[model samples]
Target: MGFGAILDININHISTRLAYWLARNFDEKFDKLNVGKHQIKITSDTVYEVFGIPKGPKKVEIIADKRKVKKQEKI
Candidate 1:
């Protein structure tokens, strides 16, 4: 495999899974709820922080049904 390909695969297998599993089992700031389009979503920027890859500044989205309802009700 090429250098870039190897790097991508490693990131996918290790970093991605590690971040997800940690978020699933340990992280609690991000809350999960059922929404219309997406069934599960959380409100946390910890994923990128955990990934720790210096990409550009990007906004993270956290979606949840209860949050949506709260927003709609102006609560």
Candidate 2:
């Protein structure tokens, strides 16, 4: 395969793993009742932050942010 193809595969693999990790660990943290149209931002190769609506009557007025560590960064 070409370099581009390999890079694409690697990216897909990383994203899939990240999704699974988030679902397993933060499923309840970002439930439908607490979030709407949630957004995830990757802060680094092994860290990511999530933003979403907070649960409550004023969900539309507030946004919740959570940061998670995926793996230790190399020194």
Candidate 3:
């Protein structure tokens, strides 16, 4: 919960039935649920509303490896 936000909410147990259905129903290419004839829209707003996770930009942390990187050689 609140993945990209500073104030994160505690995680609770997920619904096994619903999760299973979603896993099987979700279409990656369409970004929606293609269950039979129904096409359920899955947007950023919907995601935030459903999961409480931030639908905004995320902060990325990169750790540089020192040992593997060599210093520039003089020309």
* Top of the candidates by lDDT: 3
Q: Name the better of 2 and 3 by lDDT.
A: 3
Determine which window of 10 residues in candidate 2 has minimal summed lDDT.
Answer: 44-53
Clashes in model 1: which pairs?
Answer: none
Compared with the true structure, what per-residue lDDT tens digits does model 2 show for residues 1-75? 113333334331245565566665454443322134665433322121122212344433342443432343332
- Against the reference, the lDDT scores of all candidates come to 0.43, 0.38, 0.69
lDDT of 2 at 35: 30
What is the Cα-based lDDT of residue 66 in candidate 1? 58
Pairs of residues at least 3 apart in sequence or in different chains that clash in candidate 3: none
Q: Is candidate 1 or candidate 2 better by lDDT?
A: 1
lDDT of 3 at 32: 91
Candidate 1 C-alpha lDDT tens digits along 1-75:
113333354331235554556555543454554344554443334333444444556665776665453222121
Better of 1 and 2 by TM-score: 2
lDDT of 3 by residue, 1-75 (tens): 334552364644345666678899999888999779999889988778766766678864564787654444432
Error of 3 at 56 (Å): 0.6
